[model samples]
Target: MKRRQTPSNGTMFLLLGFSDLSLAAQTSLFVFFLLSYLFAVIGNGLIMLVVTFSPRLNSPMYFFLTVLSFTEILSISSTAPKALQGFLKAGRTISLIGCATQFSVFIAAVNCESSILTVMAYDRYMAICQPLRYTSVMTVSVCWKLTMIAWIFAFGNAVIGFSVLFNLPFCESILIAHFFCDVLPVMSLACGNTFFLEVFQLIMSVTLIMSTFTLIICSYVRILTSIFLLPSAESRHKAFSTCGSHLVSVIIFFGSAMFVHFHLGNPLSPYNDRMVALSYCVIIPTINPLIYSLKNNEMKEAIWKLTLKIVALHM
Candidate 1:
């Protein structure tokens, strides 16, 4: 009898995206996701360019918003393209190395996004809770440093998370039940003991997710206290107007992420998992720009100006 080859680094993972459906259904799904991708890119791209060039948006809050827009683009781009390609391509395969790379990028984006959101909450907290010291507290250098730290921290986390799987052997059946590469899905393929890895991943997830959430919650608690202490109704209304968008965005991202991560390993609900993952990884990022823009006066004005500039150039 011939000795069977053990799957190693060269193994390929079939991304089994979207259930096997009719051609029409698949094509429709592709079109929907493609449009969503374009919308998110354009929305976030315009936000970045406007914030970079618009003098009116020179405040620390907008600076953080710009960081958020860019991060949103990066986060969604990591997973969406490959998932969209799954509809058109057969098997939708990626090499073990490629899968690992994708997971790292996706996870880094997620972590960076969470960090930025936390920082943004702090920005709002400062602006509202400490108006006199806002500029001094949120200096240009400080903002830049925070942004860099978030990026560095996220990437470092990804590196450490994947290091454990560096030499782990994969099973012969490499079919990933969901779209794109995710931490749990990728780790599930390993033939060796992954209990500690899963535990570590869960701990990290809870730590970051809950910690950031607690920070945001604490900031908001202070913010609400500060807002209510204001003598004038107009001031309280203004405070709400300023902070409402970020709060909505926070709920959206956190809600989706918590659902997906916590609800993993339900043997009876693969399709439910797929749907939730699709919405979380694809839909949420796309809608986030719209959420921020819809309520933001500054962003709306900037987008309008950018749109006119484009039309004028064409003419």
Candidate 2:
């Protein structure tokens, strides 16, 4: 395929505006992102470890949770370290291929997470709405099949998106204004009319966001109706509590993603794009495991036990 070349003016010396910031602000941002990255890794890592070791957590829920943690780690790693390096260095120039690879992996991880969350919502629905049939419906074989499908779909989407994108001709100017090489930022650098790619991305974004979110909403609606019909307050509370963490995580992840990809204006400004990108790419992943672990008793207990074992070993 012939490469689409971007105009010369679009390509310029890209500087991560932070280099112009006061030393204090630079130091503050660096420290903030550094700590955020550390917590993200540790928090997600702990989730994976806990899910792996705890027999009580060997169900479909924790299985999906483990996959989520792994995806979160991959997603954050794609962008945060490079952004941190840019803050420390005088110049942050990512090679063309490197930028494309980063975006591809990041997109794949995000898509995988979306599908996994949808599957988890379905799991919750079965557990609550059809308690007796839950096991049969969400059998071990079914769970693995769903996970595999999610991964394959995500991989295909990422490959197609990146293949289309990398084929575009980039000018000599290689500076990406944002912390990462997101679709829009990279597209803006292309000289040709990226209308088709933009349209395709919008369609994909709407389909993924709306379809998954709709499934989740339907699941929760059924759950809520069932909860209300029950006479016992405790049962209702237990059911709602079980889903609350997942609900919040879904809102943050999908909300931020939809805002950035669907609602953001075309010819978006660098500042606006970067701010929105940070919410999905950096903020959500950092907070998700914390939210899940804190709200989930099983996960909390598993973490506690693991901590104790590690401490005992040290002693």
lDDT of each: 0.83, 0.83
What candidate 2 gets wrong by more than 4 Å, as runs, is 1-17
Best model number under TM-score: 1
| TM-scores, each model vs. reference | 0.93, 0.92
Q: Whole-model lDDT for model 1 versus the true structure? A: 0.83
Q: Over 4 Å off in model 1, which ranges?
A: 1-9, 265-268
lDDT of 2 by residue, 1-315 (tens): 335455333333353746766999888878878888899999999899999998989898888888998999999999888889888575477666677678889999999999999998999989988999988888889988999999999999999998888777765545667777888777776775778778887898888889999998998899889889888999889989888989998999888877777764455577767767778888988998789988788888888998999999999
lDDT of 1 by residue, 68-145 (tens): 888878878988889887875774988878888888888888899999999999999999999999989999999999
Q: For model 1, give the 10-residue run with minimal summed lDDT.
A: 1-10
Backbone clashes (count) for model 1 = 0
Residue clash pairs of candidate 1: none
